[model samples]
Target chain A: MRPSDIAFRLYLVALFTFVFLPILTSMVFSLNSDRFPTVPLGEFTTHWYKTAFSRPEVWTAFGNSLIVAVCAAALSTALGFVTAYTDFRYGFRFKPAYLALALLPPTIPLVIMGLAMLAWLGRLGISGTLSGIVVAHTVMGAPFAMAICRLRLSQMDPALEAAAWNLGASQWRAMRAVVIPFCLPALISAYCLTAAVSFDEFIVAWFVSGLNKTVPVMILEILQGNVDPQINAIGTVVFLTSMALVIVAQLLILRKTNA
Target chain B: MTDTDPLVRFSGVRKTYGTFEAVKHLDLDIGRGEFVAIMGPSGCGKTTTLRMLAGLEEPTAGEITIDGKRMNEVSAHDRDTPLVWQSLALFPFLNVKENVEFGLKMRGVSKPDRHGRAMLWLERLGLKGFETRRIDQLSGGQRQRVALARSLVTEPRMLLLDEPLSALDAHLVIRMQGVLTRLQKELGITFVYVTHSQSEAFAMADRVVIMGHGEIAQIGKPQEIFRAPKNRFVAEFVGRNNILPGKTPGQEIVVAADRMQVSASDPGEGALPAEFLSEEFAGTGIICYFEGPEGVELKAQVTEDQLENLAPEPGQRFWLTWAPGAAHVMAGT
Candidate 1:
């Protein structure tokens, strides 16, 4: 091949290696029998996995994280779809401002957002609960969902909804019959992405998930208590959960149609 | 309304986008089962007029009535006027059978009944055995037939078409024109078609309404408009005719291209001096462009045999004349 083609291939390999090498190392060390993570001498074993699973707190944290991720994903996708549809279907004086507001949450610093949510939920008397973490994650995750749904809506034929109405479908009926089906791929993608975000989030969960520690929060505590080998086992599971969710999300929307 | 009365009427209707008027005050009456074509240049409010009739746009000023019922407040879904869009707008996510049955399903028709009716239309439109095929798999003409079937399956009293054939091949457009005309006559339903094409309108419409600049320039049978345009705009837009500045001020003469004959030598008195400019072959006929006195531009149609006999080249002097009564004097222009 040409020199530029060879360079491009090398760039891709380097990029993927940079992104995945840390995860691969964690996976490898999770099975190693060595006390400290080092190269060239450890035996392969499932000792860390057994140690991580035996702790009852890790089980509790896993359960808490799963519930928060599910609830947050559902709420974020629902809110995002509405926000996207409103942007797609309406024209008004402040439309640009409205869209900017809809997409604003993701741009805010996570620490500031986490603090704001902690304060707000404490005032509402649900602070330090699983519900508080769910609420906080929903706010942080919604803009990503909205961005995905907006891209899908842009690809849609603008006249499809109007054509449905012209064919005798009522407003609600057209939404069900045309708009929702057209955006189904985007909705599932958004759900998966938001679930992955909530499942793997750290800074925000560390602030609001007080007694109800999620997997990331548990991993941090384990790491700080000592440089525990058990951290690798939990980190591998977290990596797999996130990778599976992300892959599913990408597959749903990236399978091109003859548009 | 009685059988003799108009099925749709627009009285003092006006539509504006902010300060720009898309359709000025308009009054029109469409008889039952009539095929009417509204045509104009782009941005000439032809589509605005069609959209108003279909209840997609609420008129800014007066009223639109379908069969004596005021439709100013009627929502688009409540109207039976199904429009065949220029883009076809077929749902890519839905298969052919599902797309065709969408209207009936929304109207709460039973599943078996909807399926039977949809299948009947699909077959009628020559789309048999393609029911389960996805929209993206169909050809352009097949998708067009699908759009027609979807709109017609509702069996509405009237149908609206907005330049629906603009995207087809020339031969396919001609074929679809035949399909549309035959369907209109067979179903005995009013078809209000909007286009910018003169040929499509004249070929299929019983009457043609020519619009320009948000107003009706003229409305008449195609032959009448061809023979006698109400004004200069209709004269220029509808047919390829020689519009001449008459002998006196405030007068214009319109001669159909076919009516004027060309010759190398002077024919006699009343024959005009002209110079041949260019010629274009149009099927069996050739359109020979000429320039007259005072730089007046004109065109004459001659058969290929006639063009050979004349053998006029660019800048060749010729005599252009017509029968006295063949030229129409458009009074206002």
Candidate 2:
């Protein structure tokens, strides 16, 4: 290879290493039998993984996280699809304002959002519950879903829907048959991404999930008490699962767009 | 529909979007089973008029009637008028068969019947073997045929085409034009085709509607409109006509360059001073370019026989003349 090509490849390797080094380190340390994470290798064992899997608290928190993530993902995706479709297909007053508001959640700090939601949910008498956590995660994750779905909707030709309407389909039927199908891949990708975000989310869950601790909040609590190798194993599992979800979503989007 | 009743009628129809009037005081009558083409430059409201007929756009004033029924408030889906979009707009996710069956499916047709009808159209449009192929897998012409089949399967009262063949290659355009004409005749359906190409409009339409500045400049048979344009805009837009300053009885006149006969006699007050610039041999004839009075560039279509007889060269000063009756006189010209 040319010198420039070698330099470029090296640069890319450095970038990847920089980004993935922490996750790689964590994965390696999860397999180590050492009490504290260190560079020098200790005896390798699956004891921490077994401990993590066997714990009832861990299983409960994992179950709670799954429920919140799934619910949040579905709600956010549906809300995003509605907002994106309406904003794109119709003309209304203060449209920019509406879009800006829809996109505001992702821009604000998660801590601020969590605190605000805690106060809001307290007034509604749903604070410190699974439903409150789901609501909080939906609010946090929806902007990402909306952003992706909006992009897909914007790229779509409005004439497709028009053709459907011209072909004797009512406006609702046209959207159901043509527009929704066209945006399905993006919607799926958005759902997967929001689910991943909700799975890994900590601050909002910490504020709103009072009795029911999500996996991230549980991990934070465990870390605060002691630097257990079990925490490393659980973190590795959560990180890998979130990464897998995001990759699957990305692949689906790419396949649909043929990009 | 009877011969006396117009299938579609636009009476003083006006459409305004905010401050801009897209179509103004338009009156048109489209007969049953007639193929009418609306032609104009961009922003001349030809597409808007077609959309209004299809109930995609509501008229700001006046009335639009289909078979004597008012269509002012009817939605596009309820109106029995389908449009073949310029972009074709085939659903990319659906295969060819599904795309063609979509209209029928929307109307709640059973699966077996929808499949049979879609297959028939696919075969008729020469897309038989490509049934299960995705829209992205088809060629431009094939996709166009699918779009046509998708619209026609429902058997709407009228089919509106908005520059449907604009994206195809020139050769494909000609082939599709013939295909569209054949389909229209076979189906015997009223067609409202909107295009900017004069040749496409003239070739397929029974009558042509020429629009300018959001109003109809002229509406007549293609031959009539070509031979006798009502105004300067129609004359310039419809065909290659060299408009030049001239005079006729009781009206201000301009002579078409091709009709300007060169004569040795004094051509009178109607004649204008002009100098020959260039001549182009266009296979069957020659197009002679000239610089007229006040630097007006003019064109003249000279036959091969005329070119041989006259043998006019560049820089030739001549009295361009024509019979007064042959001159097309425009009002307020």
Candidate 3:
């Protein structure tokens, strides 16, 4: 091609390389056999992965994070379903205020939310437990779920519900048969995103988790003292799982919008 | 009207949204096995009244009785009134058979029975081979028929349709009208329909109920409502009709508008001369517009054969006349 076009192509290639090199380097280091992670010449081994797998503390943290993610996702999705349906279908006097209230938690800073949750739960003598972490994650995640589900609800035909009602179906049945099916993709996406957000979350979980270490918190602890092979292996696992969840969520979002 | 008791009765039924009354206090009786079309302008409470009858909305006042049962407290599902929506509202996720079976399934019908009934209706609606097809896969008319099959599968006593043909193409609309009329006849069920198009109301309804400002303006057979409109609103709304203001000298009143002065032998009291404005050809008839002395533009339809004798022109003034019994005068607003 032309000189300028070649130069522009080179620039794009450099930008792509800059963005992807670090991730590639990390993946390479994660498999390195040396005590200190290094470039290009280290022997590859599966020992770190095995060590990471066998570590009870790491597994416990992973399990804790999984549980917190699942419960938070389920709670957020349920609340979002209700919020979207209520806002779309009914005319309540406080709709604006209610919407603002639902959105408040997400707009607030995570640090502030974490601190507030710590204080509130401590006041009730319930701070730093798994349940407290779940509550915090659910509160933080619900707004995102609500936004996604609301968009889905807005795109759907209101006549679907009305049709069901006219066909001798109750409001509940209409929701179940018509409305819910239309919103399913959004609901699934919201759940996945909520789960992924809770899984990767550090600040909020750190404050509300007390002695119960989530995967992020455990990774942070492991990285602080030394650069262990086990840490790299655990990081790789977390990165893979998060990527999978995010990809699934994005696909669901695409389907929902297109449909 | 038939001698059989009315299947659905509305006595002073009204519904209001906040301060906006959608359906004013109104009375109507739909006889058993009758196809009744509720017709009106937009915001005239036709759909609102249908919703109230379907138990989707509760009346602010008055009573609705269906099959000798007070329906105010009954839920939508138990009302057994199926409504065919203008959008069809077929469940996109469900295939044709499943969509048709949805209502019966919700009512806890056994699986085999639901499928059997759904298949029966689907076959009856000429959709037997397409039962496995998704809603999006069907053509517009086909989707409409699927919606009908779904509603009819439940064998409801009354069917309420809210402008079901408004979304279809003109050709499809006419075809669907025939299908709907035949279905209603064969099922022998009460059909309460709401529409804003006068042609649809005229073509399909055994009786037409015209609404305005959330109240019933006139209720009668298609021919009756079209031939003898009770007031200026119904006259203008039912079809093209020429109206002019005229007063009776003794028993005879002269209505002059659009170069036509017609005299009514029994013109009602307070009739006066109305100004004639314009005229337009409408295929089978010609519509002449006039502004009555009351400042109301009135429309009148003259058939093709009648156009020859009158020989209407823009400003050529002629006497406007109608039989005394032909004019229906309303009370002063």
Candidate 4:
């Protein structure tokens, strides 16, 4: 191989190793029998996995996270699609201001957002509930969904919708038949990305989730109390799930553009 | 016009966006089964006019009627006017048959009936065996045919084409022009085609409407517009001509380059002196360039016979003349 090619390959390997080493270490330590994660690993065991799965709290937290993620994904994607379509198709005063406001949630500090949501939801008497967590996650995830969907919508040719309308389809029908289908790939990717974001969100859930604890919040609590190997197991699982969702989203976007 | 009653009429139509007027107050009439082409430079409101007629845009201050029925409030879906877009706008996700069946499906036609009709159009457009192929899989010409099929399957009363052939190669554009003319003739439907190419408009339209600055400059038969333009703009835009200040009152005369005669006779009074610049052999004839008085550049197309007879050379001076009736005079100097 050429010297430059060998150097480029080495750079890629180093980058991947640097990025993935934390997750790989966590997964390896999850399988270790040692109470505390150490340099020289103890005997390998599946006991922590069994213990993590056996806990009812873990199962409940997992279910809560799934529900919140699914609901948040659906809500954010729908809101994003509508907002993006409107922004792309219409001209109005203060459009930039509206878009900037829609995007503010993702740019704000998570701790500040969490505190604000806690205070707001407390006044509404829904603080620390599943609905509160879902709402918080939806707000946190929507900016990302809207950004991706808006890019796709902007790239689309408006003539397609015009063509549909010319062919006897009403505006709504044309959007349903043409615009929605054309934006489907981006929408699906947006949904997956938002689901992953909601599943992994920690700070907002920590603040707004009252009695109903999400998996991330529960994981934070467990880590605070004790550095149990069980936490490592669940962390590895969560990391893998988020990674899978992100990879799927990227693949979908790539496939659509290439097609 | 065969039908005395107009099929489409625009009475005092005007459209504006913010402070920019896209279409000025206009009046026009289109008879049934007439092929009308709107031709202009870009941003001259040709496409905007077509869009308004298709109900894509509503005029700010006027009424449009089709078949004597007011269309001011009718939405695009309810209007039986289909448009063929310049980009073709074929749905990338749908197969050929589904694309063609889209209109029928929207109208709530049953599956079997829409499918049969779509198939017939596909066959007619020479896409019979390619019904199930995805739109992205087709060639440029095939995609254009699919777009036409999709629009025509609905059997619209009038068809609007917005520079549909602009994206094709020159050879393909000519071929498609023939196809479009034949299709319009066979269907006997009013076809309002918008294009920037004067040749395309002249070749296909029964009457050409030339637009300038969001307003009609002139509307006439192709031959009339070419041979006898109404003004300096139409004269310059429609055909190659030399426009010069006329000797008569309130008149600017346009003389075709090929009709100017070069002679060695004594120059008469008011005969403009000119210096020969260059001559280019343009396949069938020679184009002689001259710098005339007042720095006005003049072009003359000399036939092969004329070139042989005169044998004009570079740097030669000659008096250019033409018959009095050959100059087409406009109202303003």
Candidate 1 chain A minimal-lDDT segment of 10 residues: A250-259
lDDT tens readout by residue for model 2, B1-333: 577799999999999999898998799999999999999999999999998998889899989999999999999988888789989888888999998998888889999999999999999999999999988888899999999998898887789999999999999999999999999999999999999998899989999999988899999999887777887888888655756544455554545556767643456886666788888876546878778888977777778887787677688876666676667666543
Comparing only chain B with the true structure, the TM-scores of all models are: 0.98, 0.90, 0.82, 0.90
Q: Mind giving the per-residue lDDT tens digits that candidate 1 earns over B28-142? A: 9999999999999999999999888877888999999999999999999999999999899999999999999988988899999999999999999999999999999999899
Q: What interface RMSD does every candidate have?
A: 1.1, 2.2, 2.0, 1.9
Model 2 complex DockQ against the native: 0.67
Q: Which candidate's lDDT is highest?
A: 1
Tell me which of candidates 1 and 2 scores higher on DockQ.
Answer: 1
Better of 2 and 3 by lDDT: 2
Sort the candidates on DockQ, descending order: 1, 4, 2, 3
Tens digit per residue, CA lDDT, model 3, B1-333: 345888888998989998999987899888988999999999999988998998889999999998767999887877788888877778888898999998898788999999899989988989989989987778889989998988888888878899988889999998999999999999998888899998888988999999999998988999877766677788667555554443542232222222233432325553445445677887556776656545655555666566666565554443345456555444332
Which residue window of length 10 is worst by lDDT in model 4 chain A?
A: A250-259
Score each candidate by Cα lDDT: 0.92, 0.87, 0.81, 0.87
- Badly placed stretches (over 4 Å) of model 4 are A1-5, A256-259, B261-273, B278-288, B302-315
lDDT of model 1, residue A130? 95
- Let me know the TM-score candidate 1 reaches against the reference structure: 0.98
List the candidate 2 regions with Cα displacement exceeding 4 Å: A256-259, B248-250, B254-273, B278-286, B303-325, B331-333
DockQ of each: 0.79, 0.67, 0.57, 0.69
By descending lDDT, how would the candidates be arranged? 1, 4, 2, 3
